[model samples]
Target: MKYNFDEINNRLGTYCTQWDYIEDRFGEKDLLPFSISDTDFKIPKPISKTIQKVSQSELYGYTRWNHEDFKGSIAQFYKRRHDCEMNLDWIVYSPSVMYSVSLLIRLLSKPKDKVVTLNPMYDSFFTVIQDNDRQLESHYLQAQNGTYEINFSLLEKQLKDATIFLLCSPHNPTGRIWTYEEMEKIISICKKYGVKIISDEIHMDIKLKENKHIPLLSFLDIYDELYTASSCSKTFNVPGLIGSYAILPNSQVKDEFLHMTRKVDFLNSPSIFGMYATMVGYTECDDYIDQMNDYIRKNMEYVQQFLFENLPDFHFSMPDGTYLGWIDARNVPFTSEQIQDAFVHVGKVAIMKGETYGKAGEKYLRLNCGCPKAKLEDGLQRMKKAMDWLYNNQKGGGPKE
Candidate 1:
């Protein structure tokens, strides 16, 4: 591979969120962190080169992102990569995907209107929904045989009065890429109930398998009120760039959205560097996507094998997508809080406590595998030590092989 996925680069003292800001999230410092979602790999050369070239010009200015160069990059990307027809006029820019989601929730529905989504979902969804004064109706995905499936029967009930349905494709936390049949079921129910659909496809480009993501926009023919919030940020590891876009192709919805961003918030212009970075990422960096998947897949395999051999009580499956490893420690003798204390204070390694996602996630733990294999090996060892400490101390010095 042209990129070095094995090099151990130090990120300390650089104000890096995963390494330097552990205290903010975990309330402790100096522990090995597998906490945040970003990766340790360097971004594709094309993106960095473009940013550097632009910086050399020494010109900074407010810029519009509604034009073809910005939106066209996104449209062309989806057309070439995902085989979806994206209209240039339907495209609108936002500083981030969640920003779009928060605005769409307001524009598409009213305060106190019910927003239905799968529980144990991405953590930010909880904050985004509740903070917006929207009532949340969780139609949780059922876990079975090392995978999760949406509970459609309960979903229909939840959507019956719901004004919006927020979806996470190639879902975060659990990492199950929605199949066509599953999506069809979701769409059919929403259609019957006249519910609007808003999908966050940020993880769509992080494909770890042969199945291509059927973009929510692809179902525009079946449901016109559909919208998708996505970015090349996750695919290219450029979330710090502060760029994302939304496909709001419904009647007057785009106009209302622009009013919110342009009129109310003065977010009419995007960061020039971030917009350029996104354009180059979609246009010139296709190869990096495949290489990244290959490296992440290997890291995931390493985590699986190491856990099976060393921490058998931790049940994990190779997620269909994303760099996150969701492990079920329900069978472990210790409670979630016990294991969390062990992971932080005892093992001195920070792994995300599953309960943060939702109550359904309480029995699980999420590990960020988007790092160099050497780093991943070290983090896994820390996890093992945490578990070993739990066993030795909690079980009165239980014997082991």
Candidate 2:
């Protein structure tokens, strides 16, 4: 079936974090929500159909992980898409990626032990560290010539004696797909320091043109102390279902994680339809995923061109993966809060403030481009108007304070 991504669907009053809560978050009801990472596109047909099929069943009893229905689907997905072989025993179901990260921190480190991550990443990584009572260490990615690069030297220094390294592939906000060489270096450093690596590959399937996602576990030969967390929720737009998995190869690390969860009785049964949707998504939604990627790439190209031609004062990097566009808005002559306020109040476009990610993100804002083309165009036009208005109103031919 052909999907029409051009149709604009109303998410307002739907309890959507991006839509329904925009006013509460940005303090403006008129704001267009481009803040959250989720896409505005409708769920894939295959997944929706599977959910409908499953709902026809009368029984919704105590759920057990169906070996063939659950694990088999994931193994097939990795084998087909990532070219990585995953054994059934290696997969451990968890509610979400953040939950898995918290569990790993509690299991692998004592209180106040340092947990390292790249800055300008997903905010949840920092939250996990603080919630688990672990010390947080961050290494900011240095941007050069419109691309972000990891500072290996600083990373190595931070990795010393750190108990865990939380990695974000196709990193949030910046949208970089870490090169294999970079991954190898990270793996080597963690190995030298005897630190365990917990990699979040939730956005693995959202690769842009010419970019490939390399799972951290694929480097198991170099380091066996790695745990990979992934989910179809990001790809399939079903995070509310709360189904995710941690892929662990080392039995020792696996046992540690299980013990931590067991102490808290963390085994919550997944949504009844979540199982069906995940199975169908992995088994039969290749074409849907490809089409979604194509749509997102088109939007990315449009945004890049629009910024270059009209909003030249802003700098942005073409994302290597994911539908997010990280823009450097320092030239716009406003503080991060001021820019965020303008976007919300004047531009009526809700975007993530850079400062929320980390101090390194102060001059940046992350824009979600996973929407209909018309919505994206509308957002850019609004932003252009807002900037023009700000520039015109500035005193002494410069931006106002």
Candidate 3:
């Protein structure tokens, strides 16, 4: 293979949240950090070159949003990749997905209004709701048949009085790429309750398999009250650029959101460099992305096999999309803190504590599998060894299923 994913790319001193802050975050410098979602790989050549070209320019003044920058590349990407048609007028710029969510929440709902979301979801949804002085109601995703499923009956009940719903497509941590049928049911319930949907699809392009991404907007007509927040950051490993777009089709919804943003002057002009990089990523980096997907899939498969063969105490399903793997460690004899400690102190590996997502995530951990194959293998070996020692050295007894 011409591409090299074997070498250990140094990220420790790069001010990377995944690496540089591990000591401060976990209170140990030796933690083999895997908590953050950023990838360890270097940026693609095309994107790098574009950024370099933009850097060479001397002037850094107030910039304007070009129609070409906002539309053509993304519109083509969605239409070709997901079969969803988008118009230029439907797009709005935001610095990040979280910002868009917060703005939309402030626009669509008033203080004390209820917003609904699935438990074991991205934590930002909860923050956005609280930051805007709104009430948040969570319906936990049922773990049945070894996969997470939305309990439509419970969801319908929750949506009855909710004013807004936050949907995480190809959901974070769990990696369940929502099917069209499930989405339709959600839409039907929301429509019944007059609830507007804010779907965060930031991880839509990082599929590890043949399952195609379906934009929730595609299920409804142009007049549907759906807003999509997405970015090339996750897909292209450019989160540092701080560029994202929100897709709102309903004119009233779009206008209201814009009005909210204007109050704070949230007109974030994407850096010319970031714009160039995004265009190159969407238009020219297909093969590179395919290679990345293949690598992540293989790493996930390796983790799955190791867990099945060596450590049967834990339960996890391989992610269908995104580089995050959600593992259930409840059957192991450790508290969430203990599990986190064991991984960092004993195993010299670090992973996200699932409790960060919500209460239902207490005994679970989210591991990022976007690193090199060798790094993943090393981390898994450390984890397996730690688990074995913990179980064998147990004084009382192991946990029950």
> Best candidate per TM-score, number?
1
Model 1, 1-401: lDDT tens digits are 28777877788987899999998988888989898888888888999988999899998877778788998999899999889997899999899999999999999888999998888889999989999999988877789999998878888888999999999997989988898898888898999999999999998877776666889988888988899998878888788888899998874999999988988998878888889988998999888888888989888888889989999999988889999999999999988878888888777899998898997898899999888888888888888887888887895533222
lDDT tens digits, residues 1-401, model 2? 67778889998878889998887768777688898888888888988877776677777886766477798898889989988887788887777788887887787789989999988889888789988889999888898888788888889899987999999997987888888788889899999989899999989999885768888878887888889888888788888766887888988877777666555666756666677667888999888788888888899899989999999989876789988999998887766765665566668888888888998888888889989999999999988876776667654333333
RMSD of each: 2.4, 2.2, 2.9
Segments of candidate 2 deviating more than 4 angstroms: 259-263, 396-401
For model 2, the local distance difference test gives 0.83
The TM-score that candidate 2 achieves is: 0.95
* Backbone Cα, N, C clashes tallied per candidate: 0, 0, 0
- Model 3 lDDT tens row, 331-358: 8767776566667767888888888899
Candidates 2 and 3, the one with greater TM-score: 2
Q: What is the TM-score of each candidate against the true structure?
A: 0.97, 0.95, 0.94
Q: Please report, in order, the local distance difference test score of every candidate based on alpha carbons.
A: 0.88, 0.83, 0.82
Index of the highest-lDDT prediction:
1
